[model samples]
Target: MTTKKETRTFNIENLNTRDGGEGESVIGGYAAVFNSPTEIGGGCFTEEIAPGAFSRAIAENSDIRALFNHDWNNVLGRTKSGTLQLSEDERGLKFEVTLPNTSLGRDLKESMQRGDINECSFGFIPTEEHWDYNVEPAKRMILEVDLFEISVVSIPAYEDTEASVIRSKEVNEQVEKRMNLIKKINTTLEAI
Candidate 1:
């Protein structure tokens, strides 16, 4: 069965350790690691890099406000590192995809395919600034990422929710017909 969208949460304890005390609370604030997002590269763009100009891409995330940057898709020449990201190296061709509908997905696809998308404002938080406590930047580890794709159409609670219900029904019918044909062939073989 296909699983629908669900909200998941994880909690970590003992982040604050008071230098010499039993339970450190002086550090203050909670630090969290998260999965980064990446999108497929369709074309070119102008992004200032350490060396020179570079391309950019974006992907959709479960969190509506959350957005992915091309850095997540870093692979062969894609980034300074020699490691491949979504290419054919890490594991398989694992890449983020936008649903058929939704404004962001629609808009993002247009940019990749046509290079005419709007300026997607995305930035990396210093980590500590977002929290109440002071924590060093670039020292956080990624824990987990919650991935999600948005569809323009809403899923039905029951009955028929899929927009391509007809397609599914047709395929099922085709399978049943193929089974009957196989049964007939087996019967003919037995009689012969």
Candidate 2:
């Protein structure tokens, strides 16, 4: 199953670079919120990154890499080169990354300065989620999800709720079709 990805514009104000001398720098911002509804794909959905969302993963010391444009090979701030930190707050999840003085790191910092990169996207496999059809167009509540890589992107690919809700509806439809086919086969056998 394809996991859902979330993207949000990072607050410029929250972005700060601490020069570690000789070119080392750090950049970060709030990557997600708990109760705010963001328009994704063309629909509206609100996601909550629960309090302990990252607890298990953190305990395992998973290698949560940081990339640019979701390019897996283009790993930026990592444990070896620098560091990537994720923390919880009253609003949502916050991420800070220390960048090495490498060419890639300089390029990223320049891009951010030039306003070429201002958004962050994260990938997660949902452990539990619910769609409240009681609300118009339905509102999805992602109670739990396994955190994955967080990337800096030029344009967010997850603007609408289609990726989450529409995909879910499609899955349900397929299941229903299978059930109907099984029922028809059983009916024919009974008649025989």
Candidate 3:
């Protein structure tokens, strides 16, 4: 079975633009924040990216692209071309994109500078994840991912809520089972 791609968006932090050496505009910001819990699927569950989640992908030199609004046709920069650089720091996945001197690129630069666009997103396929059922809303810790692309977005598309709800139900079942086992043990001890 083929793995499905997922996208997560965060409000842009430290987003800024500067003039490039060749008179082009360059944008940089944190695309993802590490250790921050985000409620997903309308609170069906919460998710956070573990530190180093993108380490393997970046070290392997993945050819990730930078896009506008997650649209392929609106390509802004690319890792293969050295226009897009990805790295991980204490904050999260940081990116710098040298915007091309095209209409789309120019428009994006202007919009970003005007504060009309202030969100960043990344697309990936989860390679490793862990779920904590002890929390009220099950927490999903994304440990590793196959990084694909990052985008500057206006609105973020969330994961499917139905699937999240199903996962939450499964987690609840496990929690209930554990609680039942603990109760049985307590009862047995009382009978002794």
Instruction: Estimate the TM-score of every prediction.
Output: 0.24, 0.71, 0.82
TM-score, prediction 2: 0.71
lDDT of 2 by residue, 1-192 (tens): 235454444433366656766666878886666776664434533334556665565456457777777778777766334488877777666778887678888989888877777878776677677655444444566676677777777675643456546764664554446556667887899999
Residue pair clashes in candidate 2: 40-159, 40-160, 40-161, 41-159, 41-160, 42-160
Count clashes in each candidate, considering only residues at least 3 apart in sequence or on different chains.
4, 6, 0
Q: Candidate 3: where are CA atoms >4 Å away? A: 158-192
The candidate that achieves the highest lDDT relative to the unseen native structure: 3
Worst 10 residues of 1 by lDDT: 45-54
Best by TM-score: 3
Candidate 3 lDDT tens digits, 144-179? 999989999977663454764565576556656765
Model 2 residue 109 CA deviation in Å = 0.2
What is the C-alpha local distance difference test score of each model? 0.25, 0.65, 0.85
Cα error of candidate 2 at position 64, Å: 0.7
After TM-score superposition, the amount by which residue 76's alpha carbon in candidate 2 deviates from its true location, in angstroms, is 1.2
What is the TM-score ranking, best to worst? 3, 2, 1
How does candidate 3 fare on TM-score?
A: 0.82
